[model samples]
Target chain A: QQPVQSPQAVILREGEDAVINCSSSKALYSVHWYRQKHGEAPVFLMILLKGGEQKGHDKISASFNEKKQQSSLYLTASQLSYSGTYFCGTEIRAAGNKLTFGGGTRVLVKP
Target chain B: SAVISQKPSRDICQRGTSLTIQCQVDSQVTMMFWYRQQPGQSLTLIATANQGSEATYESGFVIDKFPISRPNLTFSTLTVSNMSPEDSSIYLCSVGTGPTTGELFFGEGSRLTVL
Candidate 1:
């Protein structure tokens, strides 16, 4: 099943911060994040393992809550270049290459 | 990161017609994935192709409609058969960095417009 993302969309300004949350009904072994700009392929951001791990890439960071089967992405000091749709992919089982992506969160940062 | 190249980045097809998108990778990959995304929509997994085996398609996707061929470790092709306007979307080919890591590198994507 596809995961659910909250705050369907968020508008931010440069130097602002925002959070996007994704939750799944099933237990997950890992959570993966990706960002896609208009007319482009989704780019890999970071992956968080189970056991309440947190990962970061540049100003973007994410945390996975194993107990809750959810993950949250944090955008710190947002930049205009960060404008895009964010997607979280959940891996239900270890070694399972198959991933179910959540409904994306569209983020727009304006100067 | 693997460098993937897709052919015919954009194309227009007539209803009931077919179009094939080719994907080539710089190196051998253990797994290749096909995804579809409509404009302003989330990416949907179509199938997973492995060399020397039949592609495993996700629910709502059938081989009869989207046939995949993995001729080698570094090349694969997805053929959209009997397309309609609903099939008009961006088709992306992604390569798994490893079997367990699950980090995917995506191709530029083939944009198909069916009329």
Candidate 2:
């Protein structure tokens, strides 16, 4: 099943903070985060592994709780560039390239 | 990371016709996948294009309706056969960057508007 993302939409002003959450019913080996701007392809942001291994840009902060099968993406000091849709892709197996993306969270960072 | 190019950024097709979307990656990748995003909706996995083999489709998707071809590691095609209004969506091509981490690089996507 696809993962569920909370707060379908959020509007943030410059320097504000916001958090997006994702929950899955099945066991997840990893959770991948992506940001897609208007009229553009989704860009990879970060990935959190089941064993606590994380990879991606340093500025992107995220957490994965395996026991609860949930992941949270924290956007601190939001900037205008952060205005976009965020999606969380969950992987169920090790080395499983296939991912089921979440419903996507729309974030609008205002000036 | 890989650079992906998808053909026919947007197209208008009539019902009962078919549209084939091409995806070309600058670098050869181990895994490639296709996804569909409907109007104001989330993305749904269509299938996984396997090199030198038939594509693996997800549940609620079939090969006959959506034929896929992975001629090589760098190129793949997805054909929407017998199109309908419901088939209209943004089809995205993505190449996996990590096997364990599951990082995927996506193409610009082909937007289809079926009337």
Candidate 3:
């Protein structure tokens, strides 16, 4: 099943912060985060494995809650380049490595 | 990281005609997947292409409609057969190096517009 993303859209100014949440009904083995620019393919940002592991890069971070089957992406000091759609792909099982992506959160950052 | 290339980046086709998209990876990959993204929508998994084996499609997708060919480990093709207006979307091919890495590299994607 497809995961659910909250705050369908968010607008921020440069140097601001934002949080996007993705929740799934099924148990997830890993949660992957990606960003897609206009007319471009989705680019992989980071992956959060089960066991309550959290990963981050240059003010962008993500956490996975195994018990709750949810993941949250945090973007701090947002830059203009942060304007795009964010998708969370969940891996329910480790067998096929298949992923079900969320509806996506559109983020717009102004200068 | 894998460098994935797709042919015919964008195309305009007539309804009832079919188009085949090709995906080539720089290195050998264990798993290859096809996904479709409709206008203003999220990506949806169409099928999983396994080398030398029949492709495994998702619930809403069928082999006859989206036939996939994975002749080797580094190459694959997805053919949208008997296309229609609804088939107009961005088709992407992704390669997974391994299941444990949880990372997927994607091709630029083929943009198809059926009129």
Q: Please give me the DockQ of candidate 2 compared with the native complex.
A: 0.73
Q: Which candidate is the best by lDDT?
A: 3
In candidate 1, position B107 carries an lDDT of 96
Q: Which ten residues in a row are the worst by lDDT in model 1 chain A?
A: A91-100
- Against the native chain B, what TM-score does each candidate's chain B reach? 0.97, 0.97, 0.97
Error of 2 at B16 (Å): 0.2
Higher lDDT: candidate 1 or 2? 1
lDDT tens readout by residue for model 1, A27-107: 988899999998888899999886589989999999999899899999999999999999999888875557788889999
Docking class of 3: medium
Q: Relative to the true interface, what fraction of contacts does candidate 3 keep?
A: 0.61
TM-score for candidate 3: 0.98
Please provide TM-scores, in order, for all candidate models, with all chains considered together. 0.98, 0.95, 0.98
lDDT of 2 by residue, A1-111 (tens): 899999899999999999999999998988989999888999989888865454436455888888889999988888899999999998888756688889999999999
Q: What TM-score would chain A of each candidate receive against the reference chain A?
A: 0.96, 0.92, 0.96
Each model's DockQ score: 0.71, 0.73, 0.70
Fraction of the reference Cα-Cα interface contacts (below 8 Å) that each candidate reproduces: 0.66, 0.80, 0.61
Off by over 4 Å in 2: A51-58
| Candidate 3 lDDT over residue span B1-115, tens digit each | 8999998899999999999999999999999999999988999999999999999999999999999999999999999999999999999999999856568888999999999
Candidate 2 TM-score over all chains jointly:
0.95
lDDT of each: 0.92, 0.90, 0.93
